[model samples]
Target: MAIDILVVDDEEMIRWTLKEALESEGYNVRAFENGRDFLAYFNEHGSDIILLDVRLPDSNGLDLLLEVTRVDPDAIVVIMTAYGDVETAVNAMKRGAFDYLAKPYSLEEVSLLINKIVQANLLKSQLHHYQEMLENKFSRILGENQKMKQLREHIGMAARTDRTTVLIRGESGTGKELVARQIHFQSARADKPFIDVNAAAVSSTLLESELFGHEKGAFTDAQKQKKGLFELANGGTLFLDEIGDLDPSLQVKLLRVLQERKFRRVGGTSDIHVDVRIISATNADLEKAIEDGRLRQDLFYRLNVFTVNLPPLRERRDDILLLAKNFLEEFRKEFSKDISGFRDDTLRILEGYSYPGNVRELRNIIERATLLETGNLIRPASLPDELKKSSDLGYVAFSQETAKPWQSTGFNFKDYIDSVEKQIVTEVMHEVEGKKSRAAEVLGLTRFALRHQLKKHNLESD
Candidate 1:
């Protein structure tokens, strides 16, 4: 897009000079001899950069600056005046002028200032784009289940309370950290820093100093003063993962900080005050940990002001395929594959398995399958052996001795037998690479009998 520059000055010579110089620099320059003409043109066609002289025939530049800012708060207006004084410059800036230019200013200075503004605008645009991507990536909690809906509602409530501490409880790999991040990014402190640490990943000796800054020479390795996660996350959020694994001794210090909003760094005497929202997550059973003395009860109460409990994947079975397809699309783009969708049998296998590792495990499974798949659609052959073995059709077993034929109102024995036989025959054929003799051998049947079974089950082509 071409940059538009507007020059408003009562002096014809100055207006012509600016218009010529700015047009030479490839800007769409428009010159006006008075504030009345400038305002009329501005109301019709807005410009990117505005140069307004204070000594206008009809109006004051400071008053015009207020009007421009009132109409468009982001308007970049540069004040131009031959009688430039400290008070006039300050007044222009107070009225929302971008900068002040005294009379007899060089074109070089104007070019430099314009370049700086352009660069700043470019950076602002890039930052806005990235922020949008981040919000879209983390804000979505992909599930239509009632539990998930309630969880989102709880997250919104927690985010509204800026100072409240939040504790997320869930099984490992059930998106505890994801919930913590969602709360932080959706809150009022979204623009500030968000730092995260795993309590279990750091050693007890270093974890204290990691949470709170230390003075120079405070310890053997402390050569310089260092700020900790708490200080860095001031006015923002600090996500502490696996909070149950924090050392008991440090828990006392943490409790004091929560209660008093101040803490002394390791080997430091003076207390440092900070305003940080703490969002902690733990997969461990906190009630059990409190009873076993592994976690402090007082600290638990402080961190548990707002709690979000995530449901395991098996309980919300309806969302399994939803999450799976989402992961598949994500991986397909990442791996640069041409895969379109999952096969019907593959979808069944994905939806039937109990995900012990939850969403993270399903993501990994999709990633691996997307990378390894050779066909247009994701088939059962692309899945892991464990998934295929544990699929709904994989474990079917029927015996006449123990069968209750008339148990159901509309039971059809022949149909049930035929379905089971067809599934077994299909699985055997897949295992044997569609070799009828090998499939028959595996099923304990002769070639003729296997052929008859294949024709009956609509597997004649195979």
Candidate 2:
């Protein structure tokens, strides 16, 4: 859409010149002879930018600027005045003008100034949209349980700070990285870069170079000077994942940096300083590692300033369906599928089994089911065999009937448990005439829990 610009000048020549020039540049330009006329028109219509003469016959342009700004906080107004009124122009700017234009300026200068305003507004709009997208994508720390609520409070507190180092401890697949990112994106350093490195993923020999950079010819593969994650995340955040796995040699260097806010590059003598908020995550027990001489004691104390521990999905059963639905909606859009929800059998299976892999596993299961779904909802047929198996949570008991792992090629105990549980739930629901309240009373379960079970078993409709 063409940006609407209102030009208010008492001189007929000045008003006509701006209106014609801006209109030629594809703006919806309107001209007024005085502040009164401009205010009258603006009351009924909306404009993106305003070009007003500082001296109006009926009103002071500064007063008019204040009025427009009061009406619309985001209003953009530029003041126009004769030469030697730079001070007045500056004062007008203090009164909320977007800019000041000196009189006797060429038409080309006018066009350039207007173009800059339009581009700035465009950039602002794009930035707002981008931030919204990031929030939607990364802000899904879903849970209705008390533990989750407490976790959210801690996250809020951590995100409000500027430079507190954070330590996130959780089992693999528990979304430690997600927690780290939420903290970074919500803090004062949100607009800065968020760099992450995994101690376990990279080789111990190369981890230092990767994290601390190196000078030209620092090593055989160091063809040129390179910047480390610290430099890349300067004035931002650096996430050190699997911090417990950091090699002992690197641990000393890391401690030095944490203490002094400086480091010497791998094979480089010059000390590099950085202002980085370190957020470290580890699935390992740093305390035990410290005792075992694996992790440095001082480093653990430094990084453990604020610790956040995420619960396993099985422990937070209330969030299973919640997370499943979230993943469902995400995959629905990603795969462009019409899949609505899970079927009765599928829900029971999902709820009954203990997710040893936690939330990440559930998401992967849902993703796979979504892609394989041919109907409007996911069913037991769409679920993996392991999910449908009725194991004693751990499924640790192998088939005694089939001898051991060597003798049996195919045997499953989880299948038997699943069928038995499904049958019992199905028959109970039938006996209650599909009444959840009556079923819960007979089965010795709470209505809240019964509802989740019913949904898991695709017995909600019943």
Candidate 3:
């Protein structure tokens, strides 16, 4: 792999010698005499590696190292210092330099160090890229929740095969898109495009053309041939959000494509075969739709080859605080605020309310609170009136499950224990919106133990 290396030193002879040696070793080397020149070049075209001198005419190398690292934390910085200037080089290293080299170093020694640094940088770059992708693309999905953990496992299993047609069912804000994205990113066609189409957003007249393309002069607006989402997502995945909202006629067309893997443009004769995966999501119950003859049974079965149900926030009360924290961190960065955390009473309110809108609602609440919070902690007054009212005093009473065993009933010890456990789990679950992990934390129980108790009580989640 070709490497871009910037060598900075006040001495021309050292720069020329090092540049020549590195160039001979097949690296693209650029040299600068001062920190100003290096900074200018870095601003124009960033280098993958920066070699800095500890003592320069313009500025100290430690200061320059800090600037470079701030500009690109992933940049590989190799510092140069005199034998006694090791202390300054060590300081640079502490400030995020990859390594340091003593002054009057041999050309061969510099070449060897560059080679090792470049190779290490390449690996780090690859790892960092994957890490960024995973975090940015999948971090919203906190797999600590039991349902999310199971969904993740299912996604892994489905990614290994092409026959899996996943149907993601959930409430409006339950992160159906996130689940679909996870499937596409983990599948064999991860490198390929993942096309998203909102079936509910398009009109019945245009939805067909949007999914299966349209030839020139196919309709009044069709000025030229246009590729559809299916063609765009050829080898990858096509996420059909609100698939249940597709028009009845379009449902027939979609069903045909699912069965035959072939579709034709609106005005074209030849069939276009696509090796695409379909991951559809909807808040509607397709079985009921089929029973009402609004959706076809064959198509429902085809899409439901594999199904993943996402529980609403109210159902996963244990995850309420965790999700709140995640949202708080995100909003804090978004709004450039330094709000530390939620107040105990604030958290109490958040945990008590049933998030009818699920994770999406929680995100909006955190965003609003982060922006409104003038102090270090978020207070209940920062929340909407509806939330505050619902979660005020009544919520505290409903949510508190930390009473001693002695507080429970005395009649029938086993039955009393079951009742207490059920009540505690139920209350905590309500607080966390059915998030088993957070509920378990609130109730002082393990996730596995909570699941066991939940099964034991046969109690309904919030």
lDDT against the true structure, per candidate, is: 0.81, 0.80, 0.78
Tens digits of per-residue lDDT for model 3, 171-212: 899999877877776767776667688999989988888889
TM-score of each: 0.59, 0.59, 0.59
Local lDDT at 114 for model 1: 75
Among all windows of 10 consecutive residues in model 2, the one with the lowest summed lDDT is: 399-408
| Per-residue lDDT of candidate 1, residues 86-126 (tens digit) | 89999999998889899889999887787666546644654
Once fitted onto the true fold, the runs of candidate 3 whose alpha carbons sit more than 4 angstroms away are 1-133, 392-462
Best by lDDT: 1
Error of 3 at 330 (Å): 1.2
What lDDT tens digits, residue by residue, belong to model 2 across residues 230-267? 86677778999999999999999888888999998767
Pairs that clash in candidate 1 = none
Instruction: List pairs with backbone clashes in candidate 2.
Output: 344-457, 344-458, 347-456, 348-456, 348-457, 390-414, 390-418
**What's the best-to-worst order under lDDT?**
1, 2, 3
Number of clashing pairs per prediction, in order: 0, 7, 13
